[model samples]
Target chain A: MNLALVTSRDTDQAVRVASPLAVRGMTVSYGQTPAIFSVDMTVRAGAMTAVVGPNGAGKSTLLKAALGVIAPLAGSVTVFGQPMAAMRDRIAYVPQRTSVDWDFPVRVIDVVMMGMYRKLGLLGRVRGQHKALAQDCLDRVGMADFAHRQIGQLSGGQQQRVFLARALAQEADIYVLDEPFAGVDAATEKAIIAVLQGLRDAGKTVLAVHHDLATVPDYFDDVVLLNTQVVAAGPVAEAFTEANLQAAYGGRLTTARVDPESVAG
Target chain B: MGAEFVALSLPPILIGVLVAVACALPGNFLLLRGQALIGDAISHVVLPGIVVAFLLTGLVATGPMLLGAAGAAVIAVVAIEAVRRLGKIEAGAAMGVIFTAMFAGGVLLLEQSDTSSVHLDVEHALYGNLESLIWLDATGWGSLLDPVALAGLPVELPRMALALLVIAVFVGLFWRPLALSTFDEGFARGLGIRTAPLGLALVIMSAIAAVAAFDAVGSIIVIAMFICPPAAARMMTNRLGHQVAWSVVFAVLAAVSGYVLAGYGPLWIGAQASVSAAGMIATVSGIILGLAAVAGPHRTRNG
Candidate 1:
């Protein structure tokens, strides 16, 4: 099943003909200043890949670019060996919690129903079947009880779970999440990580823009260290090393101390 | 005198209902999108456009004047977009600046033009005449496809027919996109809905509604028809579809009531009065808005 087109000097460097998710030479700019520069990455099917980087490291930009939310100044992104536009329905995006106005007057059920909007189109009213599916997704995220409650009424962790339910309702093969764990409690974090693991176990590829480095070893099988460009990417054991962390952090590590609780987690 | 009153006032009242229905259709979309002020701005700013069209054509025709007003409203939208994109101005702020400047320019143009003899005064533009509407065509319904006729009903079918067509078109063409975009523009964009085109179409429709009201009620009063009914309906319901329905019902009621009241109000008060049909309808709509504001359900929590 491993179709390697070319064998390089390093056996690990062979270029495969197909990848579930592939981004090559991606560059993104905000107005005049470039935020991400020529980044290359890939996520194999049925794997959980975590993207870790410092602030302003363009972690969120990379996910947004992959989802076609932000146009890349350079390079291309593909899903299931097809362009993003062609496979849009097959990709689910969980934007950062802060990106949306939580105070918007919509119930959790309504927010979850938004996931079906792509298939439903503008006029396709959410009927019984769609509501059932939304309920199922919410139940899977343990938010079924709060289905009727407005999203703004929920706690921070509960709000994150609601967003998870939204993405879950999409039923997409690939998932892209930006800081799903930020500001969430331990129990909620564990629940979300379990959901991500369940997705990978179900033979789906998941790419998460993560901040907590401590959970990386336990939660993800693959890692991509980004500092504007991909510093390293591969299996977690080999790719996430102290030297690679230093390369990603550089001199910023000298002045800053990594929280023991964060590293120990 | 009673029959004379009905003869002179009925056509304008019917026309006002049509104008309110048209404006309300687009007004729901604008209010939902948090762009409610746009209608008010367009009504004020289109004054110069109407005057210029009259000056160039040397005729006070409704068609050319509406076309000119629509063109100016489109320009204002473009200017707002440009200001937002280039200068990083807030959308509301940009709209405020563009409309105020355009309106001031229109007032200046009105002062400079020899339009007094032609009845192109700013007051006439602000408050239009329903008195002369009898001279306008209110016939030709028998030639239409509908052959079922009420022989002796004193109804102006031509005007009613035109109003129905405008309402049907507004609801048919823009129902879905308007609802989706109004709720969340980003989500609408994600679903491949072209918000800019939808927004432009809505603005154009608003200008048309304003023009229609301008002839029957006047430009200043058109603001009430567009804003008050929708605002009142919004306070009563959170659902966009329901709000739209309520707005139409409210507008039609206000139009009929205002027309009837304006007709008998003078005799009842024992005073000689010539209250504009449009102004009375606008006043009624404003009163409804105030009542809605006072009686609306209060939400202690956000959402």
Candidate 2:
């Protein structure tokens, strides 16, 4: 019976290897207030997952801690079945649009080139090819024409797209974004979704902290309904139900409704 | 333009320029990071560092002073972080609480200690002795080729030059990472750049510039140069590279023109004695910043 239990555990580990990002027993706090509690989550490989929660629900905190931007009080994160440190280059992250100061004196191209820093290493010269690659990423995000323009000159949606372009320039296997669609125009929203869908088609893993619940079913294949902890995490059809939404948001979110059958089909 | 220029005016102007460049270079990043007051804080704290160093060594030497100032800068940073974290105070408030206390303590120490034999005093610390750093060994332009004459140059000149070189090299070697981290710390950290250490390194570089420049040009120029030239340069360009380049140009301009105007401006006005070159340098930098704010093309956010 013990041998059977060990074999089942080995099988579970094998299954975890196919997961792009996995977090176990993660907890984080700010000052005296706890932001997130012990939470366990695993995102499927080559799939789009949306992390949805109400305001102050630790959605952004979870992403930040998992990415090591802020130290976690407790937990471990793995990327591609390896420690996040070892697999850092294989993951790209797009911080929230408001996280950085737009008034910073840098052109659109310069911001995009930042994505290539991991590959460039310290003291590595940015070659012409690197510029072209950054430009290509900008083109992918429909921001190619704004290459010479300063970042502050662009609108909010354009800024978000530029950030996405920078993440694209990383060309990593996994893409993590925080609030990618928050304050963007409808056109930019459509364009960004199309690009993200293209990334999915190319078999890249994507996990984003999505606030808009109306588009969750259409935008993602998987959903992690979270408040302070993981309420439910699985395919959008199974995990993004009315019960899960109620459990995660309590009375804060009254309008978000997801049809399990529609999402499933 | 012969002996008078080489002996009296040249060394101060050069030192002034080096100080401006050193402070303004790091000032660019600090200003953009919205931590321009870090420079201001550092200059204010430098007095206490120098006084403490003097108290420790009982000698007014450059090496001991630099170490003491560097040590003080580090302590100030640590204290600020601690207050901000432990007391849950805002960063600006914490900085204000610590720097002002340290600076006041330094002034009190200077007053209480016996330093009548040395050239150390509040006036010298505030305005500096820029006018007195004259090259008496140089007779004329021919002194340029004379090694013995060069050896007689004020020690502050070579020291400031070396400080400027070190700052420039630091800015150059770490330009990419610094800019990236400054622009977006989270993204930079995500790329495994180690943002915290990079930030501390930047503060250390700023402290070095502050300490080195504080000795010759005084705290006034140290504070002004750290904010003005870079703030003006920021108004001139939308690109970081261009902004850095423009800051150097502005630093040089402020140094040379401020020195010249201090000496000759008073003479032209038919006055007997020249005004303080350090004060004039700081004033010139402020004026340049004002000009950029008013007329610079990229001054506004829209641009």
Candidate lDDT (C-alpha), each: 0.75, 0.90
User: What are the runs in model 1 whose C-alpha is more than 4 Å off?
Assistant: A1-17, A102-105, A125-127, A246-265, B1-6, B130-178, B258-271, B298-303
lDDT, residue B108, candidate 1 = 93
Candidate DockQ values, in order, are 0.31, 0.82
CAPRI-style quality class for the chain A–B interface of candidate 1: acceptable
Report the first chain's TM-score for all candidates: 0.90, 0.94
**Candidate 1 at residue B302, lDDT?**
50
State in Å the error of residue B172, model 1.
5.6
- Location of the lowest summed lDDT over 10 successive residues in candidate 1 chain A: A8-17
**Model 1: per-residue lDDT, tens digit, B1-303?**
344434455556667777777777787767656677887888887888888898889898777887777777778878887887788867778888998999899999988988878877777777777555541222344322234323322233343346557756866666666655665555445445677878877777776677556655577567877788888887765445667788898889887888777767777889788577767888888888888888865222454
Share of reference contacts found in each model: 0.16, 0.82
The lDDT of model 1 is 0.75
